[model samples]
Target: MAGQQVYLDHNATGPMHPEVVAAVLPYIQGGFGNPSAPYAIGQENHRAVDRAREQVAGLVGATAGDVVFTGGGTEANNLAISGAFLGRSEPMRRHLVLSAIEHPSVRETCAWLEAVHGAEVTVVGVGCDGRVRLDELAAALRPDTLLVTVMHANNETGVLQPVAEIGQLLRDRGVRFHVDGVQAAGRIPVDVAAIGCQSYSLSAHKFGGLKGTGALILRDPSGVMPILQGGHQERGWRAGTENVPGIVSMGAAADVARRDLSANMAHGLALRVIFDNLSARIPQCWRNGHAGLRLPNTTSLCCYHADAMSVVLALSSVGISVGTGSACASHSQEPSHVLLAMGLDEQAAFCTIRISTGPENTVEEARWAADQIAQAVERVRLVTAPEDIGGCGEDCPCFAHSSR
Candidate 1:
């Protein structure tokens, strides 16, 4: 934050929380022991793992027995969807269901299953408002539908899905439910028991914890299988050497997030308001997500004729950290899949850029970021698509194709 460069890309990956760093330091320095060993040091490591499990469970209104740790949200998601299908009996339903706005982990896995494992998958579409409609899913459901994996919130938009209704409908239908709570678990409260979902996925880094640590929370199902084949770990639900330090950091991060959630939410909301007001000052700027119903710290904005890649570079050059839709989509020339799913044309999606705030960012930084963005957009618009420049005089496309 030395210059004008302040990171506003919390959704992509957050700076590790201080509490999380404190929690993992001992493990990194000297507490390096295998939790599976019988020695005292091993016991200390195992105890740390247990404590982290309890903390994670407590944060999400779950019991310690319900949590199974994994490498990250992607692993948690794969294990939840693929493992559930594999755990079921032969003649298990052949098809799967999920929302179109789901993260790549969910969507792409389903695609793999269909292509390789003989599972048929259907994606329920979202409305322009960015929320999945329950009726569409209900219509897609069949006796052969083995599972439904819907994200609890859209990562790009931060719009919460109608989980309660989804739960109610799936009740007693023989179809399992898995919610991707990665983007929502710490940013918002999620009660798996309340939602009646069989499985929920979450990652620590999305909520200020270290990367490479995620959890798959499962209800007391009659059976669930491990996707990975390895030595006894994660109750045989996932097998590998435990990520002890990362788990400890995740637990500490969860503790802090739970205790300070209200305050964080309020602060983020205030900062978002300021960002929104600033965005409104520029002509032709449009917010990508549901304006009022979104994560407190995120804003994905679209400006006419503005290429997201160029806007990100221009901002970075001036010391404002942000993300174009580019990195999120693997630097592809394509627009946002989330935006397209919500009915935006490719043009609007391509023009989108996201700014997400976090605990470390200050209101002052948010203000400066907004001003920088407004100015950057005016310049980016001229370079990327001169035909779309309406508010300001046009002349600079030098940074239009720069790396984000």
Candidate 2:
């Protein structure tokens, strides 16, 4: 915000909403009493927490009692996955199913369950369009499958999964379902009951709240076990002192998202349309994910012969920000697992960049950002593969490579 930069990386994190910041300041200043205590000061803080919980629950179509605030989306996802598995009474219900393109929190937690807890995990793959194969998921479900975890919207590509359909399938099979609704909650109208997930996870940060707060909305909380064994903070499902300021801000953010849902969605769709029209002029650029089944705010495109990291750095120098993939996977040198799972080869995966817009972004900014992105891609291609610069037509290797 300090420079001439145009940020198009809302999927990674977003700036706190102005109202959320205002609402959080008072809590940060003098509301120091513990929400768990019984004194008057403590009751004031407790009320604030309760009010925030209600706001968060309302955003996702759940009751306040069903929401358990966590440190972040990662913790919420972990709680949903491990807690659901731990709740199974029958020894026969020891297996779980997951999508191949789930966030690392869900993917890694499932892996841990398999390695340390002796649970069996089956990963259903996604198609080239980046949507999970419902047929494969249905086939993967077994008599012993205890839980099925799938993300409501993909973080990298912003592909929306058919959660409602999957939920009905799991319901018919009498298995527990968990949906990581972090990317879909604020941007879309999420009805957890309609989706029919036992536990649905949402991150405040992704929707203009503070980074340290998130929630797990449990349709029924009785079956789950506490992942943290400390003081019972989140109805004994999660432990430790509550982050009062973060939680308060998260609540305010949720309120803002609820109030502005329609306008924000329209704004995001407009920005995406602008970005697509502009970026199409760049050579060797094509979007990934399903055209209609993805988030209106997101666009993932591959610019052949140009490394994603290089394009990011080049754009950064010109005061524009974008993401190669999930910010959580930023440090890894490996290609994006989401792209790879969608059938992109190693080289194509390396060349993909994710651009996501927010409510504050404008058509003018989108145009400028698109120009900068095209320039960055051309610059990277010049350095990475200079021989491919002037080559044109179907016969040229560069042309053939770009067509993919």
Candidate 3:
């Protein structure tokens, strides 16, 4: 295992669990019949899809029939946001409410609604801790607001929003609510009934399943129309031929997550504890997001005067991997919108990095990664130190004291 990398970026995506891969192998190899066909083999495949539906439903306290499989979390979010507006005929009820810290999938979908459909969008900002300001949300709500879409957990900072409270606020008002639970589903305990969201999105790959598979759990599918139309699959809620192997793996992953939820959470928290302890000793290392209300696996650190990209590259060279921000938006030169909305200045946002751990990570790995990160930060500082700051070399006590 020499030079093997330690992966600490689970929020971006996760490796498939052993059980999930085993469950999907047979379907990938030989279960090639179309679920829509009437032949015996097709019928067997149809049953497999049904069983998957139930397994996914069980993860969120939903019924099998309420789950509509989609391409991934992005599609599920788009369908939930757009389909809600398209299904209704009222031009007056065109306003949509969303959190500023939402994933790009939800944020961009709302932007599309505003640009193409002439709908009004109300974006409520988050506080310094990265939790949505509930008061601002309440003030932004109007009678014409069609639906409120909030993510259960933020992707970059892993801040857990007050989704259950938001749901309760909108529940009696007859307005629909959607929770993009892509990051929250397998990492934390999620109950669709308990959260009381009308629609919830989940990505299979996020919870140790294969990519290219996801589902939208709905309370009532009658209220939402299909985003893609042509085939009659997913009871017409979603169209196209099913991904049999991916669907099977998603189910297997969900089953494993359901059984290991508590243990997995504990494992993640252990990693975070190590990170927090190490971060305390690193100069100018400020932790972002809510301390107690954040995900157990995620720790967002902002190192003043140290470039985030440099830290990422330095770690990569040392056989450790982390993220600067959301992998989906990493291609952009712009700093994270989530961090900016949380009141971080442009420079601080640029200096931020996210470390999200998975269940397989060991304590030794965590400690080693922490030490390497500290060294990398020191190396970057030494290389970039200004000439005016004399004697601020790697061993300078004055520089270290000032950084504190």
Best by lDDT: 3
In candidate 2, which residue ranges exceed 4 Å CA deviation? 1-3, 386-404
lDDT value for model 3: 0.88
What are the TM-scores, per candidate, against the unseen true structure?
Answer: 0.93, 0.94, 0.94
Q: Model 2 over residues 1-404: C-alpha lDDT tens digits?
A: 32587889999998998999999998889888899999987889899999999999999999999999999999999998898777766767888899989999999999999999889999999999999999999999898988999999999999999999999898877789999999998999999999998999999999999998999998866557878887988778779988989999889999999999999998999899876664478877788888889888999988888888889878888888899877776655567899999998777877888999999888888888887888888888888873332233445453223433
Model 1 sits at a Cα RMSD from the real structure of: 4.1
RMSD per candidate (Å) reads 4.1, 6.1, 6.5
The alpha-carbon lDDT assigned to residue 346 of candidate 2 equals 72
Q: Which ranges in model 3 have alpha carbons more than 4 Å from their true place? A: 385-404
lDDT of 1 by residue, 162-207 (tens): 8878988999987889999998888877798888899999899988
Residue pairs clashing in model 3 are none
Question: Tens-digit lDDT track for model 3 on 1-404?
Answer: 23878999999998999999999998878878889999988888899899999999999899998899998999999999999988866668899999999988899999998999988999999999999999999999999989999999999999999999999999888788999999999899999998899999999999998899999997865557788978999988889999888888889999999999999999999899888765687898889999989889999998877777778889998799999878876645467899999998777787788999999999899998998888888887777643221222455554223442
